[model samples]
Target: MPQADFYILPSADEDSRYQFLGKLATRAISAGHWLYIHTDSEHLAERISERLWQSSPESFLANSLPTEKLHAPILIGWQPDHIPNTPDMLVNLSTIFPSQTVEFSRIAEIVIQSDEILALTRGRFKEYQGAGIQPRMHDMRKRSS
Candidate 1:
């Protein structure tokens, strides 16, 4: 299962976006999924955790976390979105920061262009072809069946 995290653009209504995230958190809780909220602010993480803890002590998260995803810098990871978090969810949550989407996109583009090495090194995957890699998706399906 893949989990997703979306950081709100700072200038956009921070309060509303957080409220939406809280709702997602509540859903996560009910599903028993792990929520990893990566944020730059330690205090904000604690405050969010505290609020969630109040609603479902049984599923309350122990902490907020930091993320190292290259795309999202100030990421927070939390789990179990059973109770949608509201602005009042935290007493000491930090203010949102403006997103550097354009900057990050440019950097990613540059890196990907420079790393054409993946195409050059595809031969390395050829050895693993026997294990799983296939030349085409249809061929892989035939083998699995």
Candidate 2:
């Protein structure tokens, strides 16, 4: 089973979620881990692609869409099957969890202050525990404040 990490953010908005992803992707890439950002839709994937590029003004994050060539270090897509199986890290940005999470060595699940997202994240945490994987929780608000 892959190690699961839940990132609880202070705000319950999509922008905050994307910001969290950008930082997480930067850290994972710096650690030499290929990142796969699985979004809920193609539009969301495109938005994330833009965010990744502008994530760091001084440094660029190599990223590409699913249909593009697989030369980038990070991939953004709505379909997990379309992503290469060799990625070391998986960042799920959607409310629905992917079934192929075990393929990656580490999975980051972001949670916000919204009730709906919070409820979904709680269920995902339980699912991970039921699968015998002990997931770690990180409250970003606590760390930032």
Candidate 3:
């Protein structure tokens, strides 16, 4: 079976990472697909599991998946672990247990749902390194020079 995993990221329209994960869980359960989410926050995990997955967080773990399908760990730009300390499990799973999941965030949907906001966010993200990282070289030059 194909492994399912993702770092659950907001599309830039949403503000909370938890919210992003919450929505993802909801969608996954709605689709009858299961996934395991790794995070340090137990409470947040529980609430999302209840609200979205409609199952216990443990169910999310039932049937583990290879992480590669997770694509690159979509670490939030700047929350706390912004330095990027991916664990060995995530790296190893990615190579073999490829996950075909999309870390849907409200931000991403917002960008697509609203045309005006989409334009503005695109401009902002272009400057950003990833999600919240500093602007890229061109944007930096545009600002400095």
Candidate 4:
């Protein structure tokens, strides 16, 4: 069974989500896990790609889009079907649950403080629990302070 992690951010903004994602991706890669970041759109995918590149001065996360040979440790794409067959982790930034939910060993859902996002994430958590997977929640707001 795949485990789900919900990162609850304080602000109702995308910037915090992106920053946390960068940190999470770096940690996942350091732990030797190949990850795929499922974005809400192509523009978001591009933004994540850029953010990952400049995540930190010493840390380096190899990421690529769907095209032009995607053999990197991390991948960023809007469509779930575009992801390769062997990613160990899936970072979901979209509102909808991924179609290929069971394909990855672990999943991360970044949740902001917006009402819509909170509601969607709650549904996703219940869905995961219904599927017999235990979902963990991390309140990033408390950790940030």
Candidate 5:
């Protein structure tokens, strides 16, 4: 079974979620992992790609949209049918559970502190458990304190 990690953020803002995602992507890349960041729409995918470029003041994380032919370290996509088979990790930013979860060795689900988000993440947690994958939780709220 693939390893699943849920990162619960302190804030409900979208910026906070994407900031943490940039950090996660940096760590994963350093550990030699290719990542596929799944979003709910093409606009979001583009938004994330832009944020990654300014993720850090010292350096920017190299990422590419699925439309780009370049084999970037991180590939961001929104469509379910366009999920890349090569990435070792999947960073799910979408509200819906990814149907093709078994394809990746690791999965990262970023959740914010909101009623709707918490409820959605809870369902995803159960789905992961149902798939025989014991997901780990990281309360980022404590980490930031």
Candidate 6:
């Protein structure tokens, strides 16, 4: 069974969310895990791709879009039809829950502190549970304290 991990951010700022995603992607890649970042739109995917490239001054996180012929360890995709099946982990940044959740060995759901986001994530949490996966919550605010 696949495992789901929900990362709850302290702020609703988009920059903070992307920063956390960069760190998470770096850690995942360092651990030899291939990651696929799923977004809701092409615009968001492009934004994330840009952020990952400019994430660190010392080193940038290498990522590629799904349309690219040569894919890096981390892939960013917005279209629902192009979900890559090869990645070991899935980083969901979309509003809708991914139907192919079980395809990946691990899943990461990033939720920022906001009423709308909180409600969406709550539904996603239940969906994961319904699929027989016990999702773990990581309160990033607590960690920052």
Kindly report which residue stretches of model 4 are placed more than 4 angstroms away from their true locations once superposed: none
Return the TM-score for each candidate structure: 0.32, 0.92, 0.25, 0.92, 0.95, 0.95
**Which of the predicted structures, 1 or 2, would earn the higher TM-score when compared with the native?**
2
Q: Candidate 3, which segments miss by more than 4 Å at Cα?
A: 1-15, 41-145
lDDT of 5 at 46: 92
Candidate 2: segments with Cα more than 4 A from true spot: none
lDDT tens readout by residue for model 6, 33-103: 99989999988998999999888899998889977786588888987777885648999999987888788
- Estimate the Cα RMSD of every predicted model relative to the unseen true structure: 16.9, 1.4, 14.0, 1.5, 1.0, 1.1
lDDT of 5 by residue, 1-145 (tens): 7999999899989789988998999999999999999888999999999999898889999999978887789999898777886648999988887889777899999999889989989999999998889999998889886
* Clash pairs for candidate 4: none
**What TM-score number comes out for model 5?**
0.95
Residues 1-145, candidate 2: write the lDDT tens digits: 6888999999988799888887888888889889888888999888889888888768767799978875888988898576666757888877776777777889899888999988988888887787777999998898875
Cα lDDT over the full model 6: 0.88
Q: lDDT score of model 1?
A: 0.32
- Checking candidate 2 for backbone clashes, the offending pairs are none
Superposed by TM-score, candidate 1 places the C-alpha of residue 125 at a distance from the truth, in angstroms, of: 26
lDDT of each: 0.32, 0.84, 0.32, 0.85, 0.90, 0.88
Looking at model 6, how many pairs of residues clash?
0
